[model samples]
Target: MMNKGIDREIDWRLRVFESLSYPTIILLPDRTIIAVNGRYLEKMGVEEEEIIGRSCREVNLRNYPEQKFPCAEQGECPLARAVHTRSGQSVLLKYHDVYGGEGWEERVFSPILGADGEVDFIIESIRDVTRVKNLEKMYSGVRELIDQVVQTSVSGIIAADRQGRIILMNRAAEELFGYSGYDIDNVNIEDYYPPGVAREIMRKLRSEEIGEKGKLPITRVTIRRKDGAEVPAEMTAVIIYEDGREAATAGIFNDLRDKLEVERQLKEAHAQLIQSEKLASLGRLAAGVAHEINNPLTGILLYASMMREKLEKDHPLEQNLRYIIEDTQRCQEIVKNLLAYSRQSNPTRQYFQLNEALGESLRLVRDQKLFLHVKVVEDAPAAPVLVNADKNQLCQVVINLIINAVDAMDGNGTLTLRTYEDRPNRKAILEVSDTGGGIPAENMSKIFDPFFSTKEVGKGTGLGLSMAYGIMEENHGRIYVKDTSPEGTTFALELPLVPMSDVILFDSIG
Candidate 1:
């Protein structure tokens, strides 16, 4: 009858038990193991013959010595409690894994009661939870790393909620905006930007035209600091979203004051380079014109004197011949002056720069009403081109030329002033160009003559260019018309460049 009842119990419960997910073990009421699933044998590294018909504790102790629970001395175990209560119970168990790591398993005991309500058998199922626990640990480590990065980044970082309440800020953000790490909750992100700027940023963040959706590309904008002073900055931003809905916005800002200053300086340097190139071309042309004019003027003087010598004494054209000789002499003098001014040394001249003088002169006259409609452009080189001249007189010469240029423009046109080194000739060139009706061809020869005025009598002293000519000679420099056309005129000044090896510069470079 006992055999029949056990067979009936096994037939009812064990029919579909092999397909259960957890590893299973079955034992009789006396604690002798009767059956074990394939998973149980595999998990324990033991065969069914080693566990079947043997005391469960004995089988466990023989296979896994570390699992030996002293049931007699200790309180009643989970298995014993399930047996006494004639019900199912579960207790979490810890075990040393085969790889020497610790792992967890939930062991559940379910008793099978017979017709007399006596516990006939116990079935235990084991569920391992080690992989889940490891995954949780990994997630915890990754979260900590992210928090550390947010707090320690080098650029300013800030975040706000949908209502513009400041939610997060890093240490860099505090330093950049001149704020301390206190009462951040009271600060509003809108305060960091000029009025309406913060709203514009949000609009850009939501627009896909600039960057991808929910992002703002790096942009240059003005930022207002805590002290209310505006500052230049570059910023990038992104909208933080949850489940495809706008949640918040975050931005990274970097101060651009120093960077902008550097860019301004670079532009100035580039302008200087352009002036140098223009001067190089001017030098080549000036030299060519001087060489071409000097030889022909000397030849004319020689042939005309030979003709005067060949004339008969007291001839009918004697008086006219004398006038020709005298006029030719004057013409030769003028030609000499036009080609090249005297290069003889002047003991009175001292080293100075057209760069400073021209700049000062421009600044002095640019604000005048005469220039209200004029576009003034300047290009001055980095290296100072020292000239042996009087500083004040050079400044006056620059002022005179600048006024002449603007007057030529008739109150509205571009005026370009440039000063650069003509290194090969050991000279510096100052060029002033004007967009105006050019000097007429007939008036060109008489331009530097004294008291030669094209303007109305009261409107001109008539001595500007002639006085500039005298000053150039005194300063050991050359002044001439570089080019003239229907479009405009450009005047060139060639001043001696003091060599670095000769001048002992106290501060500035030679």
Candidate 2:
């Protein structure tokens, strides 16, 4: 018989167990179900009386009928382990219902001790863990997919902590920075940016005006490579947060070197097209003006010469006739130059050596008074660089460029003429560089425009460059200012090169 206090203690423990939310059961040493809580009855889909006197294995099989061995006999059975160790044992097990649906449960078997510290009964508890397992599996799959995308991306991908320490960088990022994975490990992100740029970027990312809601707008920046070269890149960045706190930043960037080069080429081509149209309009106007002025100027020169011969040297009107003759001759020269600017004569092309033509032009200009104080440097190749172009027109272009360079230097600076062959482009390049004050920025675009002169009034007709430009176009060549800076200026003339074999064949035919 039990004491009243001991019986009440037992009754109170039974009540607590009955009130628990998890499925619980009490088993005798024989492994028979002696007590079952309401939760256990509901979980097993059975009545309390139906499970109370049943063997534990029989009751468990009511819910999971697919077991090939009894639960108490299986090696991994929680109850069997608990019985052998005289302690608690827990395991994850698959349970199946009558409809063949599967579920996961954590089954725990804990021994209940008697007054003499011997195992009398065992308490079994079952907790469902199916939803948690499913969620873990889904999260793992998503993480793996995101990693794959980042690794295979064409644009550079970088991730850094809030303190700007590099945590992750993709292969494309390594290629862009010219650094390998081992080199950038744990390095500060500022090491890859131009000085102070990383700090400024972080400041902007934290500001609402530039970055809001953790997202930054796409922008362009210059980043430094490991080779100490700078590259332009377009980048977009975003802040990553963990549990409502700022965590890290991620950026995606694309190298802009190729894109910028294409844009520059397009701009140059467009500018050339516009200049060509303007020159065409000016050429038509020049042709018309030259024709209209030629007849009147010719008649003025004829009548002035006739009157001058009739008048004696001592005649008072002789001096005035001389003046008229000189003025007429000046007008005729202007008309002739205008016709040349209009390209009234077609070029007769032939294969000629560029170095020979440059030498002759230099010889002619070196003796002129304007070049007396200027030093000319020739950097021509030892071998002849042959081009299929009009020799006279090319020489004339060379002389005009030299004169202009000399004038720019005020006849007291160095003028360098260089000739070389660009085999890949099949062209011969002639460069004229002067150590003079560079062309003004505002005047650069109009340098090839007809009648657009930077010289003083009456000093230039502004047709020299326009005429050179026309002659080059007719010969399938190009003339352009290569560079201009405060230090000096360089003009380049490119003409199509002819192979020596072709030149020999043409000479034999002639």
* Steric overlap count per candidate: 0, 0
TM-score of candidate 2 versus the correct structure, residues matched by position: 0.76
Residue-by-residue lDDT tens digits, candidate 1, 84-181:
99989887656687799987677788999999998988998889987876787788899889778987888899888988888888888888887666
Candidate 1 local distance difference test against the native: 0.78
Top-scoring candidate (lDDT)? 2
What would the TM-scores of all predictions be?
Answer: 0.44, 0.76
Alpha-carbon deviation at 371 in model 1, angstroms: 18
Looking at model 2, residue 253 earns an lDDT score of: 89
lDDT of predicted model 2: 0.87
**For residue 394, what is the lDDT in candidate 1?**
71
Candidate lDDT scores, in order, read 0.78, 0.87
- Where model 1 places Cα greater than 4 Å from the true spot, the runs are 1-98, 102-133, 207-212, 291-510
